[model samples]
Target: MTSTGAPPDWTTVDIAVPRRSDRLPGISMAGFRQRVPSPVDITMVAHPAVTLLIDLGEGDGIVYDTPGRHERGSVVIGLMPGELRAGGRVGDCLQIRLEPDVAAAALGASPELSGTIASFSDVWGRDAARVEDRLRAAASWDERFTIAADILGRRLDARSPVDPEVAHVWRQTLTSRGRARVDSLAGEVGWSRKRLWSRFGSQLGTSPKRAARLVRFDHAAHLLAAGHAAARVAAESGYVDQSHLHREVKAFTGLTPSAVAVAPWLAIDDIAWPASSPTRNPGTDSPRHRARELGAGGCHERQTAVRDHC
Candidate 1:
């Protein structure tokens, strides 16, 4: 693996991604290693997928912080854990993002994990340590990715799948970038609106409307990261206006669009998760070109008031 430059103050971060043929449907994996080990901190941006963070380093691999809780080591981060921060002396780590449908089967309890973070052992039971040992002992990143895919593929095949209708709704919501109306989705699926809503929540751990908003916000965040102005991003992302965009961004990340533009978490996304669709807002540059324009670190102190998007 080659080194990718981080912000001015930090050492380079080496990123490893799976080969296209090795990638699994509904799952994305990337391995990260620090060139010069040191304490690191970053505020995580909200995304549509359920995240599995496998800590493979010794000592305090990673520490997570939410409003009133703190957790260390490998963890499962469910959809939209607002204002979450991950930091500490990370060495080598594997991050896997699971589509909600895949997560339902692979995790077996995704509905219970919504909007929260759980210990890896809590979700995988005694096998968590065993899995970590196997990953840590792997001869290379490619080996680790293969081992991870095998473990997840077996679990996914063993469990019941999500409702076809619910899965369809989710796919449509994302394709539309959160502009798909709930009633229209229900109609297309031939299910009553209430039925769709109930099933979606029970199976996906989040309502359809909330999922759409999250997806929409994620798209806008990437646009902002790519150097698009807030007004333009809002217009492209289906927001009522720039103010609407600001509120949603603040709600999800506790930061304004301008702040999110330089968020370190998003800087490595194009490198770590290369399969994401390129940002193609009209008249705007693609995110891949501006991905590393981000500043060093993330929001360390929690800000209470909303700031100007600027």
Candidate 2:
């Protein structure tokens, strides 16, 4: 869901989802607001397979390339729109799409092309200045979004679909209460573990279990960010205990639950929830509740950021 706060005077923003042929029939266009700052915030947006970002024209920006999964964050500057090589970060006011290649590159693999620009530098080198010039010259946010989407569409192609069974199992696992049993999911999907993994890996670019963990971690991050107690978050997120939740949090984000709970730039509320909020009975301290707790901090931070940025 998009934030509904007061709109920015100089910038107008909207999100649209193109038809997707991948794991799901649709994709989410997460919206963000850009704030003027003394020392700019370098945001990291992660998505499954590939993530996409576009510049909304609040200011001059840069994109950095970095090794997938590397510990140290890298920085790039003065990047124009187009395909970027693996291993970089973007500057303020730039819209970013974590494309499949970028996702692959981040996961330490060579990216497979889908007719999009093969390299970030190559794309940026040619059109950055022109795009920026056009954006600056344009009078409205609608125009900027239109132009940016056109450029992105030109560079990117639709993602291929995963096996239906595999997709089903994945969604089930994500929406499940706690650590999903692989065998159980396999049974429900009518596939063996090996078969499921093979199909899932080929299509989703990550293991089903890993994907579930990521989804769960995302949930936990949201709850923590939303100001929920760690113990409550652990229970709600399906952790065996708070320690288990903490361990997973550290693994995914390199921060303790408390630290993530207060992360300045993390927007827990912005992360998409399942189509329906997963069922969680009040008496049962399910993993879902734990995940919701993490969101508390993230939601608060997002609200504050939106106000400051707007």
Candidate 3:
């Protein structure tokens, strides 16, 4: 979601992170303190990360939507969701992204929740209220982060992990920005291609080839948001050319390259995540988020990046 010309009642700040220390093998956490009483509607595109948005707001105004489901307050956003719309008077929200491997344990049902969005209450059950209360009572952002980390860590520890080979396949796909070949990954994992594909899909809810393409598209999208020419971004991101890039962008986000170039969510990546975030912007290009059309809705303010593989 994005802000307009008006002075918003709420503003958000990023926690000072020590390098990638906040980066976990199967998970990453970002701290955001948003105090808001806004009326802006946000158009959230599909992100590679399975996101958990913890709303520590004062009221029940924060609304999250996707197809048939419409939830207020806290929600868990599964991977590759269609455009999600969120807006309300949310106060403090903690957004966490987990790799499917670790996510199997952390959120309890993320793997099954793939391609969909659900409220925290739906996924975490009774503990959802208790966790939100704990976060609200936290004294500082650091404390909040610690509490979140502990909660997720405990859950992850409690659940069984995906095979090491499965984890390896995901990591390779992400590190290569989704350009890694599924056949290569299967070979490296020493499993038959069919076996690897079956396991990856069962555990991650996406086929290996689709995951690779999704990550690649995500990389191209960020590059476009950074203001690189579509041609250059396409080439660097391993797309055939600008036309191919266009097709892929539309396939996933349902928006043209120019439209995605100014998405408000991609605009705030540098600010929300600085040192630990991986984006290349040297200030020559700037995203024009004021342009009011992203698929069927508009971006309101901040959104998390999908660096799930990293």
Winning candidate number (lDDT): 1
lDDT of 3 by residue, 1-310 (tens): 2211122322333222212433566666655544334454567776667888888767665787778888898888877777677766656777777777677666667567788888889898888999999988987656776777777767777888888899899999889888888888999989999999898888887788988887787777778767789999999999988999999988777779987776655655545443223466666232232222112112123333221111
Minimal lDDT window, size 10, model 3: 290-299
TM-score, one value per model: 0.87, 0.57, 0.84
Q: Against the correct fold, how does model 2 do in TM-score?
A: 0.57
Poorest lDDT segment (10 consecutive residues) of candidate 1: 299-308
- RMSD of candidate 3 to the truth, in angstroms, is 7.4
Question: Each candidate's lDDT (Cα)?
Answer: 0.77, 0.44, 0.68
The residue-level lDDT of candidate 1 at 39 comes to 72
Model 2, range 1-310, lDDT digits (tens) per residue? 1111122222222222222221122233333333432333233323232444444334343333333321212122111112223222222233333423233332222123221222333334466557666755655444444555565454334433345686577667655733688888888988999998877666545666766776676667666656688999899888889999989876655557887665434332333333322332343222212223222211211212222131
Model 2 regions lying over 4 Å from their true place: 1-25, 30-37, 41-49, 56-60, 65-139, 143-160, 267-310
RMSD of each: 7.3, 10.2, 7.4
lDDT score, residue 177, model 1?
86
Model 1 misplaced regions, further than 4 Å:
1-8, 280-310
Better of 1 and 3 by TM-score: 1
